[model samples]
Target: MKVLVIGANGQIGKKIVRLLSPTNFVRAMVRKAEQMPKLESLGGYPIIGDLEKDFSYAYDEIDAVIFAAGSGGHTGADKTIAVDQFGAIKAIETAKEYGVKRFVLISSLFAGEPEKGPKSLETYLEAKGRADDALINSGLEYTILRPTTLSDDDPTGKVSDVTAFGKSSVTRSDVAAFVAAVLPEEKTYKRIYTFANGDIPIKDYL
Candidate 1:
């Protein structure tokens, strides 16, 4: 599949680009020119674009789209809403406009509700949930992965439903792997599920 990854410079996005580039014609959309080489080194065709404003042109020539951008933890609520929320919705619309076959979103567990997470991050979560809702209502073949607290630990190549694992976390590597695995799987289309490290292998859950 020809896939376009938004926010290709991020912690999770970068990994997704690297994992998908070798097998698929992947476009890594970075916000700055400096990040292009990093993606090119991983075999990705890098494009410069920013989700904060307008960059729908990047969606051209892609069969699938992955919205993986974030405003980071240190940013304020405005940035959260602008990038995490508005930016994601914009991508969804652009994907639909370009006749993209599928859309995948990287979200977080406990989205929307401010009561379930840390006070500082609740706004970000709310924005993420809004973006997810937009995608669900957009009439596109979509899959949403809402993972718990992210870590840098080595991936186990295993994942389970967040409900089955309770409150938990998973490594960034595992999350990227899961995204790469589901892109071509028809079983995951239109599915919205939370994931976390567990005994069940990734394939089994998919």
Candidate 2:
């Protein structure tokens, strides 16, 4: 399959590109031309596309999409709304328009219930929530993975569903592993799940 990985230079996004490139065609979309070499080294076909502007061209010949773009913590509410919310919504619409088979989103833990999260993060959480809702309602085959606080720790190759284990942090590598594992999984389509580090191997849990 050919996959368009949005925000492919970001942490989890880069990992997804690396994982997918070995067996699938990857269009690793990034904001800067300088980022292309890193993705190229990972076996991805890197392309320049900004979420804050016109990026619909990145969808060309893409079979699926992974919307991993973000405004980062340092950005203000406006950037959050623009990138996390509107940007994701636009990607969804474009994917649907382009006949993409699937769309996967990397969302936050409290995205669906922003008010329950820390007040300082309410805006960010709300933006993620809106984007998640847009994908759920976009009528395109989709998977939304809402993970808890992220850490830079190494992958454990195991995880637990948050619905059963409650909130907890997870390594970025493990999250990327999970996304790669589920990309071709029909069972995961149209499913939204929150997860964190745990004992169950990712494939077994799937």
Which pairs of residues clash in candidate 1, taking residues 3 or more apart in a chain or in different chains? none
Write candidate 1's Cα lDDT for 1-206 as tens digits.
88999988889988998899888998999988988899999888999998877788888788999888889755998988999899999999888888986999998887776577787787888899899999999998999998887889999999877742236889999989989988898899999878899899888888
Task: Give residue 14's error in model 2 in angstroms.
Answer: 1.0
Give one clash count per candidate, in the order shown.
0, 0
lDDT (C-alpha, whole model) for all candidates: 0.87, 0.89
Report the CA-based lDDT of candidate 1 relative to the real structure.
0.87
lDDT of 2 at 122: 84
- TM-score for all predictions? 0.95, 0.95
lDDT of 2 by residue, 47-151 (tens): 999888899999999999998888864589999999999999999999988999699999988795876777777888899999999999999889998888788
Candidate 2 residues lying further than 4 Å off, grouped into runs, are 163-167
Scored against the true structure, residue 155 in model 2 reaches a CA lDDT of: 90
RMSD of each: 1.7, 1.7
